[model samples]
Target: MIHFNQVSVVYADARTPALDGVDLTVPEGELCLLVGPSGAGKSTLLGAVSGLVPHFTGGTLHGTVTVDGRDTRTHRPRELADLVGTVGQDPLAHFVTDTVEDELAYGMESLGIAPDTMRRRVEETLDLLGLADLRHRPLSTLSGGQQQRVAIGSVLTPHPKVLVLDEPTSALDPAAAEEVLSVLQRLVHDLGTTVLLAEHRLERVVQYADTVVLLPGRGRPPVIGSPAEVMAVSPVHPPVVGLGRAAGWSPLPLSVRDARRRASELRARLVGEPPASRAAEAAEPVAEPVATVTSLGVLRGTVPALDGVTLGLSRGEVVALMGRNGAGKSTLLRTLVGLHKPTSGRVTVGGVVPHRTPATELTRRVGLVPQDPRDLLYATTVRGECANADVDAGAAPGTCRDLVLRLLPGIDDDVHPRDLSEGQRLVLALAVVLTARPPLLLLDEPTRGLDYAAKARLVTVVRELAEQGHTTVLATHDVELAAELADRVVILADGEVVADGPTADVVTSSPAFAPQVAKVLHPQPWLTVHQVERALGAAS
Candidate 1:
């Protein structure tokens, strides 16, 4: 259904081609998964399928790309609208309407479909994506994950033969991610729709793929194979794969069920060795709470975003704030940064009320990297953003730049911030916030676009910050990150706190929240590959 004939793409000023000699064919009615590190050509390749490559991005396409017998070079995105549907990394950029229902119908309306057909498809999409209850909500009022589902539903309503999605489930919770993937699986199996998606969270989608395409960056040619074949050698993989590698499994497991089946002997080896006690180490006495929320209640246009939520953050601790979409996790983070004032109770950071404090004064004590990294970036070039961050944070001249290089190496200083990939843009935003070295830091979906290596660098940076007496609160759906980095996990539901405890106690107990490693080594209290590796090493 999709064919790439010796295709290569090079941006106007790019020194190297984004994609080089990428010759491959995706069979009809199959789900193809794209995997690679950041700066890879995954996004560029996806754009090529929908005719947005050279047409809209101003790149030079060296070869041919055809979708469903239509050449992308000749048929622009608008001309191929009926044959292809695309949902990019950022959902905010895809909406043409203010509300969910209107947004879903906009694509079909643009295609000149009959009103009755459009309405039927719209209703069907809302139900399929669990967006029926949110049909009336404004796009701006919805949560990040909610907006993502709406974006996907909009594309699905068009009923295109091919769907191209980039990080489609990055913002969704575990259950929501499963539902979205299941819908895609149904589209592939029942409707004969061809699905091609690039996701950094391999743990969520690897098992769902019918084929795997690995775009190893740094000018290496792409590798195509089955999920197991690709994951065995792919540098970027989920913790389950990492665990499988550590334990010398003959055939690496893509899903937790498969891994659990092969974990009997390894579990026996870990009989007496408990997982390393990160929670116990973090329980040592610490400084007073850098941020405090007492019965915090917040309303977003008549909806209770946060209700009667009381929490405390001690200095030098990392807390993972987790829950389903629209569960008030983002609201709590925003409340800490003073973006939203409490409708009822109080919020304080470093002894000062965040909402009452001046913007300049508040930034020194608390900084927030929002879900949309573009919100914090305004400068034209990467260097300019770093310079501005230094000025705003009153830090050393090279502090922010150094952080960016550490988080993602080899980023061009002169490149426009708009030209960077989603993961690259997120790294810049995080560097900008880290320059302040605030007593308390808040991150909303910090690992949204980051690959395994970049995420590892981030884990290191955050841990180093904790050692210096800084508090970090991450509102995220990345279960693996919580397992690997967080000292504590706090879960919220319906604007109220539901679960709050150590990471092992919180994540290992819930099937929906457990990481790949924990699920494989269940009943043993292991949360990460590193934990299992340590236990094995000690036993040996």
Candidate 2:
């Protein structure tokens, strides 16, 4: 249903094209997955399908792109509204209305659909995406994950023949991601809708794809094949695929069920060898408490975001706050950073109350890299942003820039912040916060836009910080990251703590939070590909 004819896109004053020599066709009723590292033109290609690339982005389109017999060059996004629906990387930018129900109906209203038909689709989309309870909530008041669902539901309500989504499940929790993917699966299977999506979180959607498109950046052409075929050669892949390669399995597995079927022999090989103790690596004398929360409670409007949450963060511990979407993870992070005033109870960082501390005083005790990295960035260029961070934190010159280099090397100093890829922007924001050198650092969904390589670098950086006696608390849905980086995993639900313990104990005991490695080699205590590889190496 979608065809790209020798497509190459180049922006003004660019030395290379964002996409080059891409020629492919996506059949109708199929879910096509786009995979690659950051800056791989995945977003550019998705934008081209909805005519937002050359049309809205002000780029030169060298070749033709057709969707459902309508050429993108000839038909703008508005012209193809009935045939195509698109949700970009940033969910906040996609909303046109203030409320959830209104936003869902806005697209159909624009298309001049009858009121009755629009209402029916709105209800169906809300139910399909598990947004029925949030139907009347204000867009700004909802959590990041909730806003993402509303953004998706808005597009789905139009009943477009084609859906173009960039990082559709990036903001969603595991179960919520599954629900969104299942909705797309149903659309492709039952309704014959074409789905072309680009997501950095391959573990969530790689198993659902009917076809895979790999876009190697730097003007390289795209490679198209089946999911297994592409993942076999793709540099970026999910943990399950990484495990398959490590185990030398024929026909790499894309899902947990498939991986488990072939894991018996490997499991026997490492029968007695326990997985590496990630928590033990950080073993030390119980350090002083860096932050303490005493029966914290926060209310957003009338909704209880956090309720009676008591927690303690040590000076050198890396803790991961995890749970379902709207489980008060972000709210707790905000409370620690002093962004939200507790409705009841108290929060303290380094002996000072966070909510009551001055903004300048709070920076020394704690820093937060929020879900949207752009909130911490204001300067036009990367260099300027770093310089501004240095001044704001009262740090020496080049402090922030050096941290950025450590996190994401080879980034151009002159590149505009707006021009940076989503992953780059997120890394830059992290560097900006790290410049403060706070005793406690909080990261909300740190791996939202990061590929595996970037995420690995992040893991290393966070580990280094923990070694230096800094406390790190990351509220995330990326279970793999928690397994690899978190010394302890704290699960929250309904504004309260549900589970808290060592990474292995909390994750392995819970099926929903287990990583692919843990799931594949179940009844065994393994959480990551590195852990399994280490066990195999020792046995040999």
Candidate 3:
């Protein structure tokens, strides 16, 4: 029901069109995925459907974008609000009401929907989004995932025919991401609604998508086809496809279930045991395990944040802490550094209790990179910021400057930290943390809002640090990142340790935690593209 005919969009100050000579169409009741690396103009397409392209985000537009037979050039966002519901990446940005119930009913009330209908729709939406328990809670009290569902529920309650979501699962943990994706799946199946979503994490959601719209890259045609069809050949692919590629499988699998059925025959034909490359590589770690937590219980204000938490950190190891939102993953990390004084826990780094030590001493031993490094950055320039870092960070002015320029080549020495793109700013903020050269580093969602190239830059930099003997512990929902960088895996759920072990062990345990390659293995858990390659290479 939406069509873009040779659509080209240019922002008010832009030199080139955001969408250049693009022609696309989506039929009614279709759930289409808009996948690409960041800044691939997926958002531009969503804007046209929601009438935000020409109306809200003012820009010079060319060609026709027709939605439901009405030209978007003529229709404003409000005029099409009844036809489309738009949920953005930043859930906190879209909230219009203070309370959950009021937010759900806000749209219907604006559309002059009757009181009874509004109430019914609100109740139905709360039930559908599984927000009934939190119906009376204030919007501010909800977590990022909860707020996101509420945002979707508010729009869906109005009975919009289509939903346009930008990075819906970016901020969620595995379980929460699945919860939202499941709700979307149900909406499409039961309600016959259209879905167009743009996201960086494709492995988790691509299987559910009926159609895939691979955006034109820096220089390429946008590929459109069935999920399997496009995924089989797309350059921007889930790691499982890489496994399928290396394995030379026919009609590649989108999920483990499909891969398992096909892989058994292949496994039977395989020869001897694979080389112990990964195990050998792991054994060579030069740095010692200075921190170890055994049978630890993490508690926060009467609620168990981490129950029976146990893990050890080797100086050269990069362990990815994985779990869904409200899973107590972040709590476990904070407790490690004594940010949240655990009621019943022991975190020791080099035989020194983490929480019992002075806050200043903790900085000397462990460095934390918060989710929004913005909270930590206050200086006016790249030069001034690092100078102000806590001395334990070991950040002298020269050391910080060199670190900044090396990580982000184009980062202006004089530009305000806030002016940089999300990824650039993160790297710059991290530069400040690195100057101190602490032995243990903790990062919380370090890759949010980054473009594809930028993410690679970060992974490379972090890998270098790990190679140099820094214990890196990053808390993130990015499974691919986890698979690519982490040496170990731990999963937290509702302030309790549900899974902990080597990357393969934990991933194998949680189906939701499995990466694309492991999906090919079906029952076996493989967390990264490298692991898939090794499995296929060994099997070959």
Model 1 per-residue lDDT at 184: 99
For each candidate, give its TM-score against the true structure: 0.98, 0.98, 0.82
Report lDDT (CA) for all predictions.
Answer: 0.93, 0.91, 0.74
Tens-digit lDDT track for model 1 on 122-194? 9899889999999999999999999999999999998999999999999999999999999999999999999
| Residue pairs with backbone overlap in model 2 | none
Taking the tens digit of each residue's C-alpha lDDT, what string does model 3 give over 395-423? 44478777766665656567677544455
- As a whole number from 0 to 100, the lDDT of residue 443 in candidate 1 is 94
What's the ranking of the predictions by TM-score, best on top?
1, 2, 3
Among these predictions, the greatest lDDT belongs to: 1
Compose the digit string of candidate 2's lDDT tens values, residues 1-540: 999999999987666788998998999999999998887788999999999988899879989999999999999999999999999889999999999999999999999999999989988998999999988889999889999999999999988999999999998999999999999999999999999999988988999998999998877788899999999999999999999998999899999999999999999998899987965666551569998899999999899999999999988899999999899999999988888999999888888888788998889889999999999999989999999999999999999999988877767788788877788899999999999888899999999888898899999988888888989999999999999999899999999999989899999998889999999998898999998888888988
**Cα lDDT for residue 178, model 1?**
96
Superior candidate under lDDT, 1 versus 3: 1
Clashes of 3: 6
Model 1 has a clash total of 0
Give the clashing pairs for model 3.
256-519, 305-495, 306-495, 327-494, 393-436, 394-436
